[model samples]
Target: MRSGYSAAFKALLTRFAHDTSGAIALVWALASIVVVGMVGAAIDYSRTVNVKEEMAMELDGAVLAGARFLASSTDIDASKQHIVDTFTQTAALAIGDAADLKISPADVTINETEGKITATVKGQVQTAFMKVLGIETMNVSVTSQANYADKYLEIALVVDLTGSMKDPDGSGSTRIASLKTAAKALIDVLIPDETSDRVRISIIPYSQGVRLSSSDASAVTDGYSQRCVTERVGSERYTDAPYTSEFIGGGSGYMLGRTLYYMGYRLPDLIYDPEDVPEFYDRYGDGLGACPTEEVMPLTQNRKTLLDKIDAMSANGGTAGQTGIAWGWYTLSPNWNNLWPTDNEAVPYSNEETLKYMILMTDGEFNDVYKTIDITEKDCPGYYRRGCTSTTTKTWWYEHYNQTTDSSNRAKSLCTAMKASPANQGKGIAIYSVYFNPTSNAMAEATMRDCASSSRKFTYASNGQALTETFVKYAKEIQQLYLSR
Candidate 1:
């Protein structure tokens, strides 16, 4: 009976092993655990990746902020603390409870010599499904670097002080007053410390013309008495050529006299024969009145002088934007260095260490011009018989010359020339033009737009507050921060 029981048990075991239905169920049960673990691992990995991307973006922004702070702050410890705090706060807001983020002062590295700031951020995300696979957490790390380049800057602020600037803006503040506030704000940013020589600014406040110091005016005009000067006429009209006392009328007379008399200045009785003067010699009258009272302030690191000059600005006379543009270029052109004080001389165009910029602010159309006319002996009884008769036998005379179209054309041409970089040398002058409520003058708006280095550089401010904000924006742009990695 025992032998028969053993045989029956063996036969049952054999039948169980041969059953395919139960075999398939056993294999599927074993594989399902790995499949579920893989899916869960994938989901956990995706979550960690998302958190990593968020941390990277936030860290980039934080590093940029830190670089900017470092540029302005002398205390390295404080700047590092700012970066840590900013990254921590931003990561918390971005990743929330998804991960445990870590960033400390040690993680931020600043290279003062290279003007670089680097930051590293780390985060650990606890895995849910991956925990079953013996993985408790997934670690992620990111790094970002920023470079604050130390490049010198030379800026020319050519602002319009035309009669229209006296008009009230949308905020009930006169345009001139608003401009003063805006310009000072800009100065405060660029020239934070009075002794900083890395950045220099030249202020050219213009109405119908730009005013020079009596000495500078005399130097440019060969001892002309007026402090005001206009655009040069000739091949060098659009160039920043150094002024000369040499003659332009075939060496017969001094170019100085021609430049002065052709810009509506009445020649002194001692210099020219009164009998040779034409009947309409004074037709344009004296144009010195149209010159702005605020004189041009050459490249200066003195913030007080610049602000005071802007404060002294008053508006009267038509807009002669071309003249303003010409002077603006001269202020930054190394070719005109002879006229400026030795300490304030402009850097050479071949200087790769410096950047040149021009900020042109206007609120009206360019409608003023000092148009010249050549009067020969035939036109006038003795036009050039006296003072200017030796060579050309022709005298140059000027009038207010209300030619808006020509004035606008000249302004645009000057802008083009100023924007072109010196051939095979240093960088070009970047022009930033601001038009404040120029709704009535399409020509003015168009000219300003064309003058800007790029379409994005052109700005329009509808009110005083906007104008101030625009100036601040430009100042920040000029002092830009870059992400190196």
Candidate 2:
């Protein structure tokens, strides 16, 4: 009986071992390990993604900071270090105790030619749940780029040297004085020193007109030593062409009338050549003061001379903004390149290679001009030519030669001509206009606004401080070393 019971128990254990019903449980237990691993991997990957986003943001901040330093700082090595330190600080703020963050000098590149900065960062984060799956860490990397370049600049400053500029600008300093200071400040920023040739500046200080050397005026004609120049009679008046046959009377030229004779102290022919006087003035000397303003300084790199010229500017005449505009444009016009020194000659207009700028500033209205019509009649009120007038000094040639036009319209017409023509109209010159504390003459202000290349380039300064600020802003804009990515 004992042997039979043992045999039955052995048979039951054998049957249990062979049963397939428990196979599903073993399969499910094995699959659970894989499922847990997948979930852990997802969590680890998500954490890594967040870290990468933070790193991207931090890198951008770092590159921008670095690029700004690169733009303004002359020390490239110092600037690069500053950039790295900035990046490290930014990364630390986002990831505390990130002992594995790595950045190398080789990862940062600055291309001066392209004016760009590129930075690359790589790092690793130890996995938490992923480690259970034999994954010890996840790798993350980010890259960022920025642009910073300084371009070439050519600028012409057309300033009003009218008598009004002598008036107070409500800032303790006179308008002329403030202008000198602001102009000098601009020079300091643009040229800095004589070594900086990236910028060339020409200052055209105008009142009634732009004064030329007596010699230059004498060379324009045979007998007349013209001390003043009027707008050409027709279309040529508004063109960039040389002032050869463009004067009134279809360039018949200003023939000195019969009645107006010189005073007791007969000056040089260039100074006061009468109708009968021979044209003795030549072109080899300084300007004849024909269409006179302070002797204009053409586009020049001489910083000291420019500053000294500005210091010597004294305000004393009527406003002839058109004359100032004409001279300023001439300084930038390649057509008049022969009139300047070879090294200081104006560059021709280009589709992309060159940039030309003109800044016109005025404190009052346009109220003066050389002449608007041909002279056929006139009379001298006094024996001295200086005391003559159109009404009282009427001679047969008086009204004919003394004709005048609306000075404001004359200025506008000149501006229109300057801003028109060229491959891209107005592209040849980027015009900037400033009206300082204008009063009563809304028309003058409107004209000036229209003269600007666009409304965005116009500035109205109500006080001396504002004017100075305006000049500083202009200098910064002219020094356009912008950053790009």
Candidate 3:
């Protein structure tokens, strides 16, 4: 039996060991193993691909964060921190396993060009199954950038409703009427949302000065007394609007009209009453009340407020733009009190993400100002050849020239200060100055240009149509600045 069994085992071994005859089965077995290995590899490859995709997405987020940080500040360290933070957050979300593995991440490269930021990143992901085949890890990378842009904006419109704005339009519509139509159109473009506090506009209709709404007027000072617009039969100022104008406060050019960008706005209660004369004169620069026909309204985000104010605006009063400019700047300025959030708490200024701006329009030259004849004559440059021409009190043309040295200097100084003020220094607040029906007796075009943020920002309108277009153009430019960061 032992012999027989040994012989049988030897025979079986010989059969299994046969090279030619048994080779086919061996080949078949090996082929099966190969197929199984391929299948397993496919599953692992799919998982690795998914992991790579997630990593790429995470890298994208990291890049965007870096770009946003750059947009907010010029600090390199801050941007780096933002990049790292973003990458870390994304990495956490992308990493799938609880087991720690070696991770190699590329350094964030920030490329700033032409006021834009671009970010690039690279990283390597370890593979679980693929590593068994001598592959240690998979390489993955991605790049992305944010425009670092400003999405929304806050604009303040300080319009001159003086008699000049009433100049008849060639289309039969008066300058004021066309202005209203144009202003309404501007509002349509300005407010993506009627109630969105995203952007707020304050309308100041002034002849000699701006008139705040009854609410604003009462708050600034004793509105019951010294209110110019409500009481003055000829005044066109809107009391409900923010008090003051660049001109009224003793400013010149658009400097007197653009009070919002620099001085910001002051509450009515803070200013003294104008009607009280000697007692109020000290603080009278705040501005007068609106005429019976004067439009009275406060800083409102509603489209209706702006449209209605434009419609109700009527020409009256002497143009005192100095006070107007100071007030306009006051309302929008960060320095103002009680005008901030109702909770008296600070909020992140988002769309205000970029800068603030103001568009000032006037139909006529500064005919009414605050300085003496000698001062006006000296400051007029070439514009006031009549008044600031000489120091003599008996000048022949000084009386006819309304632009006083005090007002001219005030406007110039206001412009210089507004553009250079700390709050507005880098705000890039562009001032567009429009002088309609420019007279040789008034400030020259060059002087007007000087009153603006720059030559590129100032404009002069020789006619009513030009005046309308000028304002429309100003609105368009400001809109672009708001839309593009």
Q: Write the per-residue lDDT of candidate 3 for residues 95-202, one digit (tens) a residue.
A: 753452334543655444443444445555555555545666656555554554333344556666766565665556677776677677667655533453345566
How many collisions per candidate?
0, 24, 68
Q: Model 1: per-residue lDDT, tens digit, 1-485?
A: 99999999999999998889988999998788788889999999997888888888988988887766654445678778888988888877887753344433328988877878888877678888977778887888889988864567788999988778888877889898899999988987777655455678999988766777756765776553336667776778877778773211111111223444454432222233222443433443323235677888889878788878888888876677888898899889988898889877889888876788899999978876654456544333233345444345544434244667888888989999888857215447899998997355688789999999898888889888889999988877876777877
Give the range of the ten consecutive residues with the poorest summed lDDT in model 3: 246-255
Clash pairs, candidate 1, are: none
Top candidate, metric lDDT: 1
Q: How far off is residue 385 in model 2, in Å?
A: 8.3
Per-candidate Cα lDDT values, in order, are 0.73, 0.65, 0.50
Runs of candidate 2 with Cα error greater than 4 angstroms are 1-151, 220-230, 245-293, 372-405, 423-426, 438-440
Estimate candidate 2's alpha-carbon lDDT, on a 0 to 1 scale.
Answer: 0.65
TM-score: which is higher, 2 or 3? 2
Among these predicted structures, which one has the highest TM-score? 1
Q: What TM-score, computed on C-alpha atoms, does each candidate reach?
A: 0.66, 0.61, 0.47
